[model samples]
Target: MTKLSLKSKVDFIFIIIIGIFAILVYSTRNQSQLARDSRMIVHHTSSINTVLEKILSSTIDLETGSRGYTITGNENYLEVYNQGHKNLEIWLDSLRAMNELNRGQVLKLDTLERLIESKKQISALTIKTRKESGMDAAAAITKAGRGKEIMDSIRKSVAAYQNQSVKLLSANLNQSEVHVKSRNWNFTLFAICTFAILFFAYLQIRKNTERLILEKIIQTNLMTELTVQNQQLNDFANITIHDLRSPAGNITSLVATMEQDSTLEEYKVIFSMLRKVAQNLNESLNQLIEVLHLKKNKIIQQELLVFQDCYSRTIESLQGEILKSNALIKADFSQINSIMYSKIYLESIFQNLISNALKYRDPNRRPEITIHTEITKQTILLHVSDNGLGIDMSKNGSKLFGMKQIFHNHPEAKGIGLFIVKTQIENMKGRISVQS
Candidate 1:
């Protein structure tokens, strides 16, 4: 994966981490708020119970005052009755306000109100009868027990209100317990998930480190093996140059000697063929030695050499071929005048390109080769193009620069030229491309 994509994925994970934190914070807040609401419900329910008790107490006080006034005909007792009646109204009003949301409690409070009003009226009537119609009338009303009946009704209604309030308080307490349990569970789950994520991250990091270390070890061993193989290759190349080229040189000498005395007309073609084969074999060996020499010499010998000068030398080497083909050559190195390169390799590269272009020229058309250069901050680019019998790249793309991989139907197409050029360029830490 790319660094940017990995970074993005890491950022996404952090976002998820942050999101989890937010959810925890939000849930914690909700849990706390729920707890507070539960406490408030308890407090309000108690307040309501207190108010109902006060109402009942005030009603009893009213009843006691009425009884005293009726029995002893005391004006001071009527003042107590008046005080209790005022307190009863105030407490009932508070209870009604507190229980407004509870429809059943409101109805019970309404009934309590009516019962209190009726008891008050009956006590007042009994007291007024004691004042106006004397003890006989008041005592008769008491004997009938009408005021006691009204007081009993008031007490029953108050009890009903108290029972309902108790039920609500009990329900609120149960809900508070449920909220407490839920919040605990939520915290527990959050802890578990966080631990799991951290554990997984640790495992992945350790695994990746181990894998990377293993890969580095393998790469080190491969590089060491490659170095040994490359040294052996150079040694074999040196051996071939000494042992094989000496015999080729001897063959060339024999051919030259035989040619000097040749008189048989029919055997002339055979001698010429043998001479050509000896030269071709010697040339291939020399090219191989050059390639292996480059591979063995790991140290770069660089110089600031003019590209135009190199191309001129290459043309000079191919002077005979150019004349034979009547080829036209063009050079434009103005864009990039010079390069830091090895003189021998650079010259060989140009010579091979020019020679191949000429060698592969179409019989129906005159050969034209163009050489140019471009300069960038990083690289010096050289381009060589030709109007010749071009190879079909699509058909032989993979093998284009492979050894002994010929493409064209040319008598002298060895196919090792492009491979050598590619090796030389790459040895210099440069890359090459083919368009056709």
Candidate 2:
């Protein structure tokens, strides 16, 4: 498992907190919406009940007024009967307006309205019969009216509707209660989770503070050790340049004077070989001096130069040697540019590799030096290859870059060129290797 950093853990907790907050908001909104729907259901049911009561009251008024008119022949009673009929129609119209409640409720409503209409028609017929004819005709009309059956039906329908409305109201109340309970539980969970998140965040902050202090102490100790090592390295470089390089310079001067003496003719080949050996030794010593000086990982006035431009400078410095050897120098830096590198060291590196190619050129073939660079996963690599007298890996591979170890019998085969290249590469924390 990958371990999470402090920041990652904090972010994860923050995300969790946001998610919980969102869920709580959604839950609360859902609960509120449910409450609204429940209220609407109750209100609709109550409105239906009120309309039914009005219809019942109006029917009672019509019954009393019609009976009073038949017995006492009162004009005021007829007016009451007319007004009750009008009120009945109004109440039924109100019920019809809310007819979209439920399919069963609408069907029940139709039956109740039909019963009320039947009662109104009978009452109107009975009153007309008593006014036109006599008590006997009105009695006959009453028998046909069937008022009791119609009233019973109206009552039964009203009761059924009331019962259904009550059931619906009860169901809505239960649903609202459940929503409220769920919302409360969710809010409780949110509060508990929020508290836990804060507690863990506090602990994580404290742990991070302690870790930062420890890291600072470690960094300070490391800095002190690095300072001591740097001083020791500087002392070592001065000793190598002063104490070791002076003897090599003196040896080179002695060999040059000995080479000029005319009396050494009988042993001229020996002297020449001795001079070559001393020069190689002196050159190798000078390379050691340079390596010591450059061993420190310090770039003095470092510059960012184009790789192609650096190669051009090196080629210009060795123009005579390149032409005399009939050498072809090729370079490619097309894919990348402005690579930050030490200009002086880059020029030196390029010069040594190119000059060695010319000096060690094969007798039968002209020298073709190819210098290129490419980026790898870990670092940028600089490659210098030549189609000249290449080193015989099977013979001189072990000493290819060793001090004073020569690969070819060429005059400049002091083995210091690649050593200098390797040292400069090391100072920059880079690796150098050869495939052949």
Residue by residue across 275-341, what tens digits does model 2's lDDT show? 3433333333444444434544443446688998767655544544654567888898765655667
Q: What lDDT, from 0 to 1, does candidate 2 have?
A: 0.65
Model 1: which residue pairs collide? none
How far residue 132's Cα lies from its native spot in candidate 2, in Å, is 1.1
Identify the runs in model 2 with alpha carbons over 4 angstroms from their true place.
Answer: 1-8, 140-145, 206-436
Q: Give the alpha-carbon lDDT of every model.
A: 0.68, 0.65
Clashes of each: 0, 0
Clashing pairs in 2: none
lDDT of 1 by residue, 1-436 (tens): 5454645656765677678879978997998798789768866875675676567657756865776677677788788789889989899889989988988888887787888888888888888899999877987887786776777687677767767776776677677666655665665566556555555545644434454345446645655665565444434333332223222333333333432234444233333343343333334445444544555475657789999877865554454466567899999999989988976668768867887898789999889999999988868999999998887888998888876678888876666677767877887989999897
